[model samples]
Every structure is written in C-alpha cells, then in structure tokens.
Target: MRGQRRVWVAAGVLGAAIVAAGLWGIGGRQDAPRAAAQPAGIPVTLARVAHEDLTQNIDGVGTVTSLHSVLVRPQVEGLLTALLVEEGQMVEKGQLLATIDDRAIAAALEQAEATRQSNQAQLRIVEQDLQRYRTLSQRGSISRQILEQTEAEAARLRGTLRGNQATIEAERVRLSYTRITSPVAGRVGIRNVDVGNLLRTNDSSGLFTVTQMSPISVVFALPQETLPRLQPLLGGAAPVVAHSRDGGELLGEGHLNSIDNQVASSTGTIRARAVFDNPDGKLWPGQFVTVDLRAGVLRNGLVLDSRAVRRGLDGAYVFRIEEGKAQKVPVRIVQEVEGRSLIEGLAAGDEVVLDGHSRLTPGARVEIQGDAQALARRSQP
Candidate 1:
C-alpha cells in the first residue's frame, strides 16, 4: 500500500510542473507584445522664426599701427647739446625737442654777415669811383679806357655782393637747424643720443621716433573668396566694429580705410585696413588683434542657429519640424555671422530643430519640449 502512494505522488508533481511551464510561456509572449506596442518618441527641441537684420562678417587676425609714424633725425651734423623733452612724452608739432651745439654755426653765420657787409661797402665805393670816372671822362679829364676799367670793377663788386648775400642766407638756415623740433603731434620715443653726443646728417640711427596715436590703423588680410561680397560693402556708409582676439571686447569702431589691389599669392588673401579713433591710446603699434569686417544688413532673410545646421552626403541641411515629424530639409547657407547662419530654401515661419538631431530623419515623429515662441522671441530685434 505505501509503494502505491509513492507512485501517485510522483505523477502529481510532474503534472503540476507541466502546468507551470505552460503559464510561464504565455506570460513571456504577452510581455513581448506590450513592449513592441510602446510608442517611439523622438526627443527634440525646436525654434521658430523672426524677422531681423542679419549681417555677414569675415574674421581675420590683424595688427595695430599708428596712422603716422616718423623717425626724428638731424638735418645737419653737430654735437647734441641739450635734450628739452623726456622719453615717451607727448609733443606737439613744431615743439622744440632738443638742441645741438650752435657755437660753430653761430660763428659761421656771423662771418658770412660780416663778409656780406664788406662786399656791400666795397660795391658802394666802386660805384662811386665809376661815377666819378665817367664824369671825368665826359669832361675830358680822364681817358675813356679808364672809365671802362672803373665800370668793370663796379660790376665785379656788385656780383661779389650778391654772392655774399646768398651765402649769408644759407648760413642763417644752418644756424636755425641747431634747434630740433617735432615734425608731428605725437608721442616721442626714447632719445637715441644724450647731451654732448655727436650727430651726423642723414644718420642711420635716428634721434627719436614719433608716432601719432590719436587715430590708429588696424590692418588685416581676408581670404580672396570674399572679395566680391566685400567690394560692395566697402562703399557703404556704415561703420564696422573691431574686437579683440578673444572676440569678447570691442577695441574700436572704424570705417574701411583701404583694400589691397592684388591678392596674396601664398595665402590667396586680400589685404585690408581700417582706421579707428584711438583717443585713449589703447591700441599700440605692432600689437596683434582680431578683425571683423561687418557688411551691411541682409533684408528679409532666414537665419538659423549655427547648431541647427548639419552636414550630410547631400550637402548642408537642417532638420526642420513640420506638423509632428522631423523633415530633413536641404538648405543653402548664404552667409554666417555672429553665431547664426543666413540660409535660403526655408520659409520665415518654419520650425528648426535646435537639439537632439542625431537620430532624426525624414518623417520621424518629434516632441517639442520647450516653448518655440520663446526661442523666436529671443532673436527678435
């Protein structure tokens, strides 16, 4: 009777295991269908359009320089006697900066004046004698030949007087050169020569350097591909702002002063320059800076954030949202400025996806998380 009970227990356990297996398979199939039915929501952010003026700009590295720089050199050879100005002093035009030893020049000038006076006295004496000789010759008291000799002497004295007068004028000019003056209104650099130093005319080493910093110039080179677009704006009446190398600070505002006639062969860049009013003397000569060439406004254009524009096999494109799906629309970027891109082939009110574009494609369902109107409002004006 105990053996019969054991067999019955084993059969009951097997039948229970089969029933449990059947329930587990049914639950797994039911969960799989539920997971497949879940909706695939594309996480995305969107932006709306607004009307604003978009400017195209070219960025380049440049250098600051004084509009006018001059080297001070002595016009005549002499010993430097006195320095009237200190180094790095602001001087006005015609301000006396230094003085050379004028003793030799003064003595030469005096000698020339005395010689000129002597020649004038001798000329007067000769003239008086010639008149007397002519009168006597007409009265038959002196020979005509003698009168001719007196006349020749007077002529020679007059020539000598004229030559002496010219020499005196030249000597006076040389004497005036002893006082060296600033040729331009600017800040004077370090003096090359001290007191009692000998200097020469046309010396290779200059006495000092003067640079006019009230108005400064910033020069830069732009890629030649932008020449066509830049040529028109060059004639525009708007001013352009220049920023520092980091692009955070505004150095000054200036107009397009000049552009080079030819492009650089090595870099294919066209050289350009701008002039700024550096009244505070912030910009210095030879300082490297960043340049921004701002072209005038683009009217009635669509500008998208730089992050929205993407590159693909078909060229540049942006994932634009239409209805409830992401529509990858191909766009042609006309220009980029100030972290925004000016593009075509997009309407004014189209929605542009600003974030979560990696998995986006044509007809992909999207859910906009933020206020699209707020994004558009930020770019207004």
Candidate 2:
C-alpha cells in the first residue's frame, strides 16, 4: 500500500508539468504578430498627353557672314600720303579712307589745260584768216585751191583742240583715283599699308578690308530634300533664329534671304542665307552658330515629353498607364520641338509614363504618384 502511494505522487507531478508546458505554447502562439502582405503595384510617375499648338523647325549649323565686304585698294599708282581711317573704325559709304601723292597728276592736268587753251586761241586766229581768204578768193585775188587748203587747216586745228581737251579730262580722272575711298559702309579691318608707302594699281592685296556688321548674314546648307518644303517660305520672308554654337545664348533673329539655285552635287545640299539685324553686334563674321528655321506650325497636335517615347526592334512606342496597369502603345513621331514630341496613335487626354519605364512591363501594376500638372508646377520657380 505505501509503494503504490509513492508511484501515484510521482505520476501526478509529471502530468502537471506536461500540462503547464502545453498551456505556455498555446499562449505564445496567441501573442506573436502576423506577417504583412506584399504591395501589389509598382511606384511610378505618370503624365497626361498634351494638345497644343507647336511649331516644327529644321536645324542646321551655319556660319555668320558679312553682307557687304570690300577690300579698299588703290586704283592709281602713287605714294600713299595719308590713312584717314583707323583700323576697326566704322565708316560710311564714300568715306575717305586713304590718300596718295597727287602732285604729279595735278601738274599733268594743268599742262593739258594750258595746251588746250593755247590751241583754242590759235584756232580763232586761223578762223579769221580763213574768212578773209574766202572773200579774197571770191574777188579772184586768191586761188580756189588756197581757200580749200585754209579751210582744211582750220579743221585740223579744231581736231587738235578736241584731243587736247580729252587729255585734260583724262588727267583729272587719274588725279581723283589718288584719293581712295570706302566703297561700302562698314567697319574697317587691319591696315595693310601705312602713310608714305608706295602703292600700285596692280597690287594683289588691298589697303584694308571693310565688312558690314549690322544686318549680317548667315550662310548655311540643308539637304536637297528640304528644298521642296522650304520653297513656299522662300519668296516670302521665313523666320529664322540663330544661337550660339552651344545653344546657350540667342545670337539674333532674322529672315531667310535666299536659297541657292542648284544643289551642291558633292554635299547633296542646297545653300541658304539668312539675314539678321545684329544692332548689338552679337553676330560676327565667320562665327559658327546654331540655326533654327521655322518651317511651319502644327495646330492642335497631340504631344508628349520626348523621353516617354521609346524605340524597340519595331519602332517608337510609349508606356501608357491605364487603370493602374502599364499598357504598351505604339506611336508614330511626327515632329520633335523643344523636348516635346508631336506623336500619333494617342488621344489628347491619355496618361503616359515619362520616366521609370525600365522596371515596367505590359499588364504590370503601377502606382501613379504625379500627374502632368504636378510636373509643370515642379518645373516652375
């Protein structure tokens, strides 16, 4: 009876310990936290397609050239006596640029005039004698042949007088050539000759150069295919804007002046010229510039950010957001102006992805955070 009671007490203790461990495990399961669910959509920003008037432009690289360029040179040979204009001086048309020694020409002109006057006096005397001889011949005191010879002599003296007068005029013109003048209004370049330098008419170079800065011209070329579209804007004044090579500054604004008659066979391009009113002298001769030729404007066209348009093995496409999912939409790019693309195959109010497209695929869930209005607001100050 004592052994049986000891076994019952040990068994009771073991059973109580097991029951306590089971209760502790059940409480621990009830107290622990559950795992959170994964997000169903990706984070992305979306922008709505815009419909506005946009102008399409053709871009080209061109050089600023002078509208009027002249090389002042001596037409008569003499000692260069004076340089009236300094280097880099703005001069007007017909402005005196330089002078040569004119003493020799002046002296020759005077000699010619004196010879002409002396001949005129002798011709008058001859005319009087001829009249007397003609009257004497009528009275049979002088022979007919003598009268004829007197008349011939007077005619010869008149011819000689005419020749002398022509010589005087020639010398006068030669003297005028000694004074070199600017042929056109412009800023003068570096001086090639100094005062007292002997100049020749056949000099290969010139005394200096003058180039018109205001109302400058830019010469550029476009592919032959552009000529047809540019034809309508040719007769009329087409607008053109010029910028610095880096396109950071506005150089000037102008109109299309002319187009070449024939395309350059080697380049397969047609040359064009644009005129700018560079009153501030921003545009300079021989300067390389970026040219924008506004061909025409597309009215009420569907446009989007340039970055939204992507290229694949097929062509251009855009990732459009529809009902919280990305949908691939193929588009045709008509024109690109100022980072905005005029595209087809999309409505005016469609929402497209502007960025973060690499992580997106068709039917992929996305969370639209920003819209077009938000982007515009962020872009402003």
Candidate 3:
C-alpha cells in the first residue's frame, strides 16, 4: 500500500510540471507578437538651424509697357506728298515726320497776303485824307457835314484793313499745319499711310504709332497681405529687379514708380508700377514678365529650410531635436525666402528635423545621419 501511494504522488508531480511548461510557452508566444509590433527607434533626418538674412519679398506677374505711347496723325486734310520718317525709325520731338501737298494752302496764303497789303495802303491814304478834312473843317474851308463824312469813310477803311490782316494770319496757320511733326521723342511704328495717300481730318486711324522705349514701365499686382510691409519700403529709393520666366536670367532693374490708391476688391490685390531704363529694348509693351519687389536687408533673423516646417492641429511647428528626442515646437513664420522660412520662436543654433517628420512624434528618439557641414552647404545662402 505504501509503494502505491508514493507512485501516485510522483505521477501527480509530473503532470503538474507539464501543465506549467505549456502555460509558459503560450505566454512566451503572446509576448513575442507584442515585441515585434513596437518599433525599436524612430528613424529621422535632421538639419541644423542657423541665422541668416531673410529677405521678405512679394512676387507677381506683370507686363512691360512704354512710358509714353502716341498715334501719329495728320492735323489737316490733304494729299500726303512726302513721308520723311521710315518705319521703326527714331524721331525727336517736333521733328518733321511728313508733308502734305500744300500748293492750294500756299496759294490761299499768298492771295490773303496781297489783299492785306492792298488794305494797308488804302488805310494809309484814308488816314491822310481824314487829317486833311479835319484841318479844313477847323479852318472853316469846308462844311462840318462833309468833314464828318470823310472821317466815317476813314474809319471804315481801317476796319477793312484789320479784317484782311486777320484773314492772312489764319491762312498762314493753315499752311503751317500741312507739315506733320512728331509730338514726342520716340520710336515710330509701322506707317499706315504712304506717299500720295489722301488723308482726311475726320479720319480716326492714325498714320503711325510711336512709343518711348528707352524708359519703360512695368505694372504688377501684389497680394493685399504683402502690401503693408512693402508700402514703407516703397518710399525709399531702392532698385527692384525683374527675372525671366525660368527665374534663371535677369530681365532688367528698375525703381518703383507709383502705387495704386485703392486695392482691388475682387482679387484682394494692389497694382504697382516701376520704371526701367530699357536702352537695349529688352522689355516691350504688353510682354508678360516676373516681378520681384525687394525689401531691404533683414538683420539677425533665424532662417530654416522650408521643408522643415510642418502643419499641425495647433499651428505651424517644426521638429526640434533635444537630447536625441524630437520635440514639436510651435513657431510663427514671418516670411518665406528662396525655399527657406523666416521664423520666430527659434534660436540661432537648433537642430531641426527636415525629413521623416511625419513618422516622428514628440519625445521620439532620432538618428542623425549626416554632419552639419553638409546640411549647411545644402541650405540656400
């Protein structure tokens, strides 16, 4: 009986040990899955934040325009006898551009002058006769009524002389109008009328178009938000530059000429104009261009790569690495310049995570792969 009891106890002990081993194995399998689910460390790319001058600028599209443009037209109606200026030729102000057939106008002027000279001679003779009549009446050699008649005749002759003189002056003015001259100093465009073409005073189409190309105007629009900052700088005499469509080449440099008084309600923008010396004729009227309004230098500002900035539920923030862990720092962006951001709430030297920000959380560990020198080189100056 004693041997059987000992056998049963031994069997019980072995069965208990087997059950415990199976439970341990099950727990180990569950824990293995959990361990695999958790990440070992957060993988991220980092960039060092440094200070640099951040230029706050606004960009917009604009068109080149001539400072002055005019359509050349004849002031009088006549046959076009001569065209002195060629198409696309430069002309000065008051330079004779064309001449109309002035033979009829000249003949009228000559006839008027001859009549005026005859009137002047008759007026002289009448004046002398009136003086002699007055003296004869005062000496009682002639009747008072006869002297009065002579005086009235003299006055009529004087009036006729004045009328003839006015006619002559009018004819002279009409003759001078036959010669067409440039109203301004500019380059002439294609001519619409050729020699022997009959031009009329009532015609609306001009003979040619002239434009001042040396000093050109550029008109551009700016967003309402950017206008306040730019308004103060515009008062200063500073140079602005325009770039090509690709932004690789500089089209020209100019100064802000004027700003519109009212903002555009529909677009929430303001129009501004600038003047450029286009001696090379690089800018032409109605040609679209890119405008850059350069605000003055910014001293001691913190700049970061534009990619480093991220939008969160709260606001704009950046991933700053502190003690090998990323901390989301809220920042206020002042401006964006050349693919970089000018921000507040950041110091001179801070390590910011530029890439892999989506996977990173506050207090998450980070691994910086490259040196600061490489990042510095990559940053825009």
Candidate 4:
C-alpha cells in the first residue's frame, strides 16, 4: 500500500511541473514579441494650435454664365447676300454681321422717290393755277365755283404728295433692315445660315449667337438659410473666387453682383451671381466651377492644420502629445478651409500630431519627430 501511494504522488508532482514549465514558456514568448514589436515609441510630427481670425469660405458649385446672350436673327425676310462676319468672331455693337439682298429694297426705294417727285411737280402746278384763279375771281373775271374747284384740286395734290413722302420713308426704313448688325458687343457663335441662304424673320434656327465673355458672371445657389448673411453683402463688396472643377487651379476672382429676391421652392436655396472681368478669357460660358464666396471672418478661434484633425468614433479628435504620450482629445470643428481648420475643444499651445498616425492609440508613447531627426543626424557623424 505504501509503494502504490508513493507512485501516485510522484506522477502528480511531475504533471504539475510540466504544466508550470509550459506556462512560463508561453509567457516568455509573448513578452519577447511584445518588446520586439514596439522597441521604440511611435515617431510623429507635431503642430501647435494657435488662435487667429479665420475667413469663412462658403463653397458651392456654380456655372459660368454670360450676362448678355443674344441669338442673332434676321429682322426681315430676304436672301442672305453676304456673310461679313465669320464664326467665333469678336464683334462690336452695331458691327455688320451679315447682309440680305438689298437690290429689291433699293429698286423699291427708287420707285418711291420717282413717285414723290411726280407728286411734287403736280402739286406745284395745281398751286400755281389756284393762285391765278383766285386773282381772276377777285377781279370778277371767274365764277366762285371756278375758284372753289381750283382750291379743291390744290388740296388733292397736297394729299398725294404727303402720301408719296410717307412711302419713301417706309422704303428707307425697310432698306436699313437689309444690313444685319450685332445688337451687342460680344463674340459670335456658330453660323447657322450661310451666304445665299434665304433667311426669314420666323426662322426657327437663328443666324448665330453673340455672347459677352468679359465682365462675365457665374451663377450659383446657396441654402435659403444664408439669405440674411448674403443680403447685406450684395453690393459687389463680398469677394468671390472661382476654382476649377477639380479645385487644382484658380479660375478667377470677382465680387457678388446680385441675389435672387426669393428662394426657390423646389431647391430650398437662393440664387446669386458674381461678376468677373475675365480679361484672360479663363472663364468660358457654360463651364462648371467651384465657387468660394467670402462671407465674413470667424473672429478669434483655435487654428490647427487640417491634417492634425482625425475623425474618431466619438466625432472629430486629435492626437495631442502630453508627457510624451498621445492623448486622443475630442474636438468640434467649426471651420475648415484650405489646409487649416478652426477647432473648439483644444486650447492654444497644444501640440497635436500632424502625421504618422498608422499605429497610434490613446495613451500610446510617442517620440517627437524633430527630436528623433536631430538624434539621427548626430549619430550619423
């Protein structure tokens, strides 16, 4: 009985020793990898939080629109005689664009002039006869009926002369319409009618379009809630900036020209326009762009590089460095533009991580990037 009990005790002791060794081995392996995984703290750059005035940039998508766009059409029906202007030609106000066949109008004007001359001659003859008849009637050499007939003839000839004169004026006005001129100063678009094509006033397709390019305007919409803020700055005082659709290039700069009187019921927004003196012709008609309207300034606020602001589950937060450790601080972003942001939670003089956030967590030890760089340079020599 004593030998069996001894054997059972020996087996139990060996089993306990094996279990202890296995646990120590597993724990040792874990500690080795843990120390190797993070031999040094995460290296990250830092940026200081500062307080300054930030300009509030209200961004929106807009389209470049011309203030004046006119579709050139013939005012009268006639065969297109000549195309004086070509497609894409820049023209001035009253500049000749095309001409209709004026030969018919010219012939009609000549005929009217001839009739006017004939009427004038007949009127002269009738007046002279009336004058002679009047003298004879006064001398009692003719009847009163004869004097009345002479006066009546003179009045009839005067009416004919007046009618002829009016016809001449009408013909002259029609003749002027034969020459088509641009009503506004602008660049002409595609030509719809070539020379020798008969054009009519009722033609559905117009001759072309004259679109003013310079002093151009961009039309955009803003939320209806912005009406009060936009109303007071509609006097061309608020500066407007335009960027390319990709926002890589600055298209032009201008000022707010006007705002819609009423908000659109369907869009819940109000329309506004900004005018630019597009001297370089960078702004083209019907081009889409991103607009930044300078509404106002945001007074004093905390400013930080936008890169430092990181989105977290709790909203926006920044990895602030304190005692060489990262502290995730929740922040409220007030305004963000370009590469800077105005935050509400953090105070001035707080250092936040600018980059190297791939392995960062709350309370993670961090090494200052500047200090690490200096140490590396010193060690190299």
The digit string of per-residue lDDT tens for model 2 on 1-381 reads 999999999999999999999999988776653322334578777767877888989889999999999988888899988889889899999999888999999999999999999999999998999999989999999899988988998999999998998999899999999888888888999988788889998997889899999989999988898998788898688899999999889999999999988999999999999999999999999999999999888898887888788999999999998887899999999888877888999998788887788889998888877665786333222
Tens digits of per-residue lDDT for model 3, 207-289: 99888887898999988887777678676855778877666678899988888899999999999998999877788888888
* lDDT (0 to 1) per candidate: 0.83, 0.88, 0.84, 0.88
Native-to-model Cα distance after best TM-score fit, residue 138 in candidate 3, in Å = 3.7
Candidate 1 vs candidate 2: which has greater TM-score? 1
Residue 234, model 4: lDDT of: 71
For model 1, residues 82-170, the per-residue Cα lDDT tens digits are 88888889999999998888899899889988998888888888889888887888899988898888889888888888888888889
Candidate 1 vs 2: which has more lDDT: 2
Residue 230 accuracy (lDDT) in model 3 = 66
TM-score each candidate.
0.82, 0.80, 0.82, 0.72
In model 3, which residue pairs have backbone atoms overlapping below 3 Å?
none
Model 2 ranges with Cα > 4 A deviation:
1-42, 133-144, 312-315, 321-330, 361-367, 371-381
Query: What residue pairs are clashing in model 1?
Result: none
Candidate 4 ranges beyond 4 A from true positions:
1-48, 122-163, 310-332, 349-381
lDDT of 1 at 77: 88
Please give the ranking of all candidate structures by TM-score, highest first, separated by commas.
3, 1, 2, 4
